[model samples]
Target: MGGYDGLVVLVGVALLLTTGRCDTSCGGTDGSPGVAGTPGRDGRAGMKGEKGEPAVKAEGPVDEVVLLTLKGEMGNRGLQGVMGPKGYRGDLGATGRPGQPGRPGPDGKNIGHGQQSAQQGHSAFSAIRTDNSLPRYEQRVTYQTIVVNKPGDFDKNTGYFTCRVPGVYYFSFHSMSKVSMCLRIASDALNEKLGFCDYNRNNDQVLSGGVVLQLTARQKVWLESFRDQQPSTDQRDTRDKYIIFNGFLLFSNDPELHFSLCGTGRGGFYFPVCSVRLPIMLHHFVLVIGALLSFAVPVKVAMESCPAAAMPGIPGMPGLPGRDGRDGEKGQKGDPGAAWAGGLGPQKGEKGEPGLMGFPGKRGQSGEPGRSGEPGLSGPPGEAGEPGTVGTQDRAAFSVARGTNEYPEKASVIRFTKVITNINNDYNTETGRFRCRVPGTYYFVFHASLEDRLCVVLKLDQTLLTSFCDHRRGRRQVTSGGLAVHLSQDQEVWLETKDYIGMRGKPTGFSIFSGFLLHPH
Candidate 1:
């Protein structure tokens, strides 16, 4: 069919074919596009399609969010997004720059002050500040000082004052005769009477003596006066006239209207200042001068300057005695006595044994003529004698008889009690004891002496010893004719030095050489 010629035919065929699409094509098919089946009527349109979730939108560096309301109809839900992977960390920020600096503040200048000025010599802390018109306050002594005297009255014009440190005090007081001046000091926080300077000089003189007082820091002290006797003069006027103290000075730093409740009666300065100020180093000089002056009071003790003395020479009498003439030479010693010079005698033993007759003494130079004997020739030497035997000793042995043969028996000196008789020695004091063999009175003498402090004291037990310094040197002394000592039986007499003494020769011994029993009474 070429275009127009088949057009109608094709159209017819298409319609027929379309009409027959539901019919089965072959044998036994369950479902197919065959003409046998017819189309069911269109079911109600399927429910409208579910809507999707709107996409989230984002802008630049910052994030944006939106909110939406849900519709009343049901819808299919969208899937959730997966979580993102972790991101890398960012770097730390840089440190900041430092800030700037700031500006500076006033000048200080010193004004006027004092108390530290005279620390070198001839100086001490002045009582008043340098600004004479002003008083001291709030300030204290920068250095330590000594107070010469207390500056307080009996709490009259001054505030109560306390001592600050302990030291010696020098004080002065002046008053007339028959009046009493008393000084009062407070310690342990109470006023106490310290000392009294009673002026009892009806002769218009002053009496002064020292009293020591001890004080400590912040201790209160005061001075006062009293009239002891009933004087004809007014006591109050006399108290005002007195000024008797000078020891040490204590002070307070800052001065105000306040003062030690003190007064000096009705007077000039409570404690006047001597105008001269000295360097502190010169303080020793002041002390020396003050000490000198203090010691020089009462006229008798005044110092007298004088020249020095020469050294002393050896002590001796001024002139020498006449010299003695020299003597002749001494003779030589004589030979020993010849053996058996005299008639032979019997041998002797010790005192216990019968003593042998003493060998006959050398022959006396007598005039007796001897009968002549026949002349003989010389004889040969005799045989050597045998050694003599040793002798035994005895206890309580008596000494050989003593003989004073130096001088004639009549010329030898003798003592009854001591070696020196009172006639020969002065100051020789001696005591004697005697046993009465004949019961008769005896004549006795004393020999006592003190050879330049070598004193001799004599005493006897069972007897009254009487002695005194006769002061007569070198003599035999007898008991005073007026008083005498009588003794009987046995008595022990001894001598001793009255003081620490040395001896000259022997000071004591006794001998009866011619001490005769007599009727001395």
Candidate 2:
């Protein structure tokens, strides 16, 4: 069967080749195609054949120009090619235009519904004591120097600041004294103390204190000495200012309210709008009564209108509306209308009671969120806070000197009795020793006038810390020594003479002893 099929294919190819050659050589015309033929039955399926060999290459005529062309079926797509190498980075693009403005935020709720009614009040005063004479015990300290007295509330002669406006006020005082003094800031109206300062020394020292007070109208504030203590005068410079007192209002609690007229008229005054809506008979009666009272009682007209120099006040609030009138009697019903139009209407009935509330409807689907709004403007800054109180720690210091020159006293402590500056009272005038209250490092120094051989030793709790000596023959000489030592609480430190002593003190020699805390533990 294979041989027979191969023979038929070879014969068909040979006949097609011969016919094409003959037609080209003899130039014969094409014959008509035959159509009438009986149909044949379908043949059986054949076995699958092996792969065929590729066709050999054939060379055509060099210059054979073919005019007619036939369309061919499209071939299957080829496999994808290899990927290309990575490309170089591209140049940056130009910047885009600015975006549109953002949506505006919602309006804020109003705080106060009307215009402001009052302004900030201001009242401040500062005075200094000028008289050097001592006052009687518990007397008020008077001031001859008036630095500033805004609103003229402070009376210099009486040394008292009388309150005219009710508000919070701050008061402070500074005094320089050479004697033990107790000064206090007191309210005269209440006869109560507000603040005080205790300064005890025999030399010049400054003491200061301050306090804040909430005061009412008619209250008075002044400075007074306690236990007959006197703030001594500054002997060196009489012109130097001392004993200064200051007071100022921080804020007010009351707002001023007054009536104002709207038109320029001599007899016009402020009155509510509802008062002018009276009936004709009532108006006549009020006019007669006003005329009768005109002669006996004076009618002070506190009228205000457009001013030439100052801004006007805000107008008063409006009055309430009048009441409704009574209803009239009902009328008869009307006749019916034509058929093409609407029929007769029903009469209006009285209002009925409200029905029960219905169930809530279903929630709707959520919408896309809106864009964010722009930021709001910043608010004004807040007010400053009040002054802080004074600290009491880390304030240990002293300065003492001897008043009388004394002779030798072996194995004994040299006591300097006169006090100049004993801030925390760490030094003892009777014991001639310094007791530590706060544990810390301290610096101590002393200067002694010697007429003959003298030796002084600094001791800490019976342990020698340092010493100094001076020798001269019947002639005055000076000796000084100092040291920085660490001390603990309850430790005792003092200066003592050993073997020989010639310590001169006070007015003639001016010997002194001083010490101060350097750092706290």
Candidate 3:
């Protein structure tokens, strides 16, 4: 093998060293010499050569320089081979650091001014009869006049003050009459009279009553005299301020009570000054005195019992123990106490028989359900059942599309012409009705493309189940509604449009109605 390899290497080197000379072929213009050369016979073939021995493997690694030289002397590139399989994905990169915070924006406009305006609108009004010169004397007189109307809540023409804000208010009315009469203040909104005042005298006397009432917005109040009693028609226009009606807001019904300086100090105090308007009754006086005593008594007792500072006394030494006292004789027992001396003592009675058991009480209502528990571990699957015969397909499903894109003129059933999937043939394409073939729970959905305004309702028989409505301003809009219903066999369901006008038809098949049986009963 070694000798053969060496011979082959020498032959390769000789071939590389030798250079071939160029040869030129002459054209045979003349016929004589060209014809003689053409008759030469073909050369004989050489014998077959024996197979060469296999090359021996190298013992050690090749030198770096020789390996590089061999790599540089590579032959012409071969055709590209088929692509290799994709490699596995690399690990995800680390997360980047957070960015710095941005600068704050400019200050916004103040919104408290609007809130203050809303609060200022919540005020009260007061009014009185301005015309006392009229000679007509009648009972049940609605004071149709105004003397002091604040915030303009009270109407002089209607004799009613409509509450603009819900809050607690104080109302007062005073009237003078020459004869006995009953003055009443009432509220039609409350459907009851609030307060009453009476003046029973031949001479002119004053009658006044006040009420602290909680009223809501739009509620009305008025002053009226009782129809059973007649009020004196004294025409004397004295400056007695006799007939007067007044009211003021106490506090609004806001969740958080807010007090303004004017509202808090109207009568010169941080607290509500009820004495300025509301008459203090005996109970109110007692409450005030009790509150004052409650504070003053504790302070007085604390001051009286306060210990005075004094110098500490010298430490005393321990004294010797005294002798024990002698034992005293026992006293005789007291006489037996009379029966029922302090109070009547009942005699012991005979034992009673056991009573029968009572019937059990009705069960209380069930409490709210508790949260669902975590799922348990799954069990092994059951064995497979025997193969059964293939059953016929009886799917109850339908998909319908409206024939026209135009909106219905009025509320009416929408008929469908295009049927996409109507298995079991349970849907009527002409009337757009679907009859339930299987008694089971099913899901139904309807979609409509609205251009202007449209309202569509999904109905089960004649009963409306669900509705969808939309009003588009510029372009057509699409709205859909769906419901899950437990339907019996032969139950009908359809879609009805309400007040749908100028609705563009869905040529792109956007509007659709579909239903399917979830599971047959």
Q: Could you say which candidate leads in TM-score?
A: 2
Which whole-number lDDT from 0 to 100 does residue 375 have in model 3? 46
Q: Ten residues in a row with the worst lDDT in model 1?
A: 393-402
Give the candidate order by descending TM-score.
2, 3, 1
Whole-model Cα lDDT of every candidate shown, in order: 0.29, 0.61, 0.55
Off by over 4 Å in 3: 1-384, 387-394, 501-503
Can you write out model 2's per-residue Cα lDDT over 1-521, one digit (the tens) per residue? Answer: 99999999999999999877755554324444444334444444444444333222233222212212322334445445444444444444444444555455444321111322112345789998865544444788888888999878899899889987665566667776554444566784333453233333355655554444557777998887665223444223343335888987644444333345443223333444432455565434444343444456778986344232434334444444434433333433433221221322222234444544445444444544444545544544434432222134555666676767777378899888877546568899899999998788987877665667888899999999988886653644345677998999989899999977888763434466777766779
Candidate 1 has what TM-score? 0.18
Give the Cα error of residue 135 in candidate 3, in Å. 89
**Per-residue lDDT of candidate 3, residues 1-521 (tens digit):** 99999999999887765522111222223322222222224334434444333222233322335323432233345445444444444444444444444444443321122332223445756666645442233233445456666568877666677887665565656676554434555674443453233333355555555444557778877766553333444334333334577776644454333454444543322444353567776653333333434344444433232123334444444444444444444444444322333333323334444444444444444444444444444444444432221121334666555667666657777876766446557889867788988787877776554556677788998999988776644433345677989888789998887876544444432356777765567
Candidate 1 contains a number of clashing pairs equal to 73
Those runs of model 1 whose alpha carbons end farther than 4 Å from true positions after fitting are 1-156, 159-161, 166-192, 197-202, 232-240, 249-521
Please state the error at residue 148 of candidate 2 in Å: 1.0
RMSD of each: 67.5, 44.6, 56.7
Per-model TM-score, in order, reads 0.18, 0.29, 0.26
User: How many clashes in each candidate?
Assistant: 73, 0, 1
